[model samples]
Target: METITKIVTRFGGVSLLPVAVALLAFVLIGAPSSWVTLTIAGLAMGMMIFLMASGLSLVFGLMDVMNFGHSAFISFGAFIAASVLAGLSGWLGSDLIILNIAALFLAFAAAILFGMAAGWFFEAVIIKPVYKDHLRQILITMGALIVAEQMILALWGGAPMTVHRPQFLEGSFLIGDITIEVYRAFAFMLGLAVYVALYLTLNRTRIGLLIRAGVENREMVEALGFRIDRLFVGVFMLGSALAAMGGAIWAGYETLITPALGGEMMIVVFIVVIIGGLGSIEGTLLGAIMVGLMANYVGYLAPKLALTSNMILMMVILLWRPNGLKPAVK
Candidate 1:
């Protein structure tokens, strides 16, 4: 085990896992253009998953809250963003880029705002009573998720909603034989920007310091007069907002969404969190990227195995490193 750890560390650790997977895929694919296209698609998909899962990771890792209802935010965010874009169809179809940008911004803003508010309420009302009790947390959160899905059904009906994209994000870019969707590129950039902001905030700021300290020793921090409960609520809210933003972007990616979107994505989000080491943001990103790449590559290579690829990956990873690739220091 020590020898394997040393080898991985020598080779730049698990961050290179994606690169290694990409290289293997390139060799198997044997076509430069196809490989490039697949790689980019995988990266973009990974970023979207990261956005959705990062919040769940933090909530569970730091707050010790098993929020099975997290995916409810994803569903709500997608629907809210889609509704906003639908209402602003004129702006989306306008020739003016400014209107297009405004419409897009409003849709995302609404989703984020709704997510934050909902998260705060959930934390305060549903979660507070279940603290430190894993079984109750799971049961209540799952019930909350079911209720959320029913709410979506009531609001949007049973039809699969079509999500319209702004003019700016409606096309694809071609480079030689490699083609990249503009929306995918936008998603990747947005996810990366969020990651940078999160990394800096968690590792470099005073609030981050307090959060980390609270995570390590909540009683000590509370004794030091730093309102840990309030900080936890903020963390929950941030996580929920991120999930909503991710859903909004994913809605555009899928172009069609249903009430089941959250349920479908919940499994993938949890897989990423568990295999990525619970509360570690970096680990979540790594797990998400690897899942993305593996899914795409497997779908192309062996369609029958694609559905189970992530589960297989998780099993193998656990067998190799049970603690996950980059677990946060407790």
Candidate 2:
């Protein structure tokens, strides 16, 4: 095993795990029909995980801050989405089916605004105070998470809030013999659009380029007369907005909103981010894709041990590369 580890490490630990995943997938997909179904499911899951981790990557990259409360923002977005949809349904005098369009639009807006609110608060009070102190940010955000949780409980009660699929989005879309949920299809498209737009912004736009450069050397960028403080605001806001969008989509998928949703999702997000790298956007996307597929397949193989797959991957990656699969060195 040690010799095997040394051989794999020589080529980069990142390649080793993914290579393992590929072989496992190849084995599982020996049958054509089952393989196609699994592939579609994996693709759909990968899209959402990518978006979720993208936000986390951006924030961590520029700010050198670990937003432990990001999961709370996700919960905030989900509940806000549910509340908006419910309100829209009431206004239309129709069921969930009748109001999906307007409901989704409003939910998107609500999630963005709520996410911005979380970012602003975090940046001003908690995050700002802990400049180079990751421990402080973690502690403070954990406290904020508790308060946020309690407040949610007070406002919405402890019962789970279920959202019914809009009439148009209720049924599954059958492509041949495989049935795919209409909403998952919608989420996948949205996720792709978001990823493309974000990727372009990071790679093409001037602001995006500056952010990338800054992530490489914050002090250098600052010394070069770039307006880093303003850029930080933009980065934080953008990350938060992405987080909210992901939350709204997630709410649509599950059709239920709970205060604990963020906490539960947080574990996965953390695993994805850590496995991918601390400050690498591309790493986030790749890690998300692997985790998403691993999760679904793990559940199929061992329902009780599903969550362990993600954490186990993260542990293996950390042992091999302490900085992660992709660290923002360039």
* Candidate number of the best TM-score: 1
lDDT of 1 by residue, 118-226 (tens): 9999999999999999999999999999999999999999899999999999889999988999998999999999999999999999998887776667789889988
Q: Residue 269 of model 1: what lDDT? A: 96
Worst 10-residue lDDT window for candidate 1 reads: 209-218
Q: Which runs of model 1 end up more than 4 angstroms from their true locations?
A: none
Native-to-model Cα distance after best TM-score fit, residue 68 in candidate 1, in Å: 0.4
Q: Please estimate how well model 1 matches the true structure, expressed as its whole-model Cα lDDT.
A: 0.94
Model 2 spans > 4 angstroms off:
1-23, 90-99
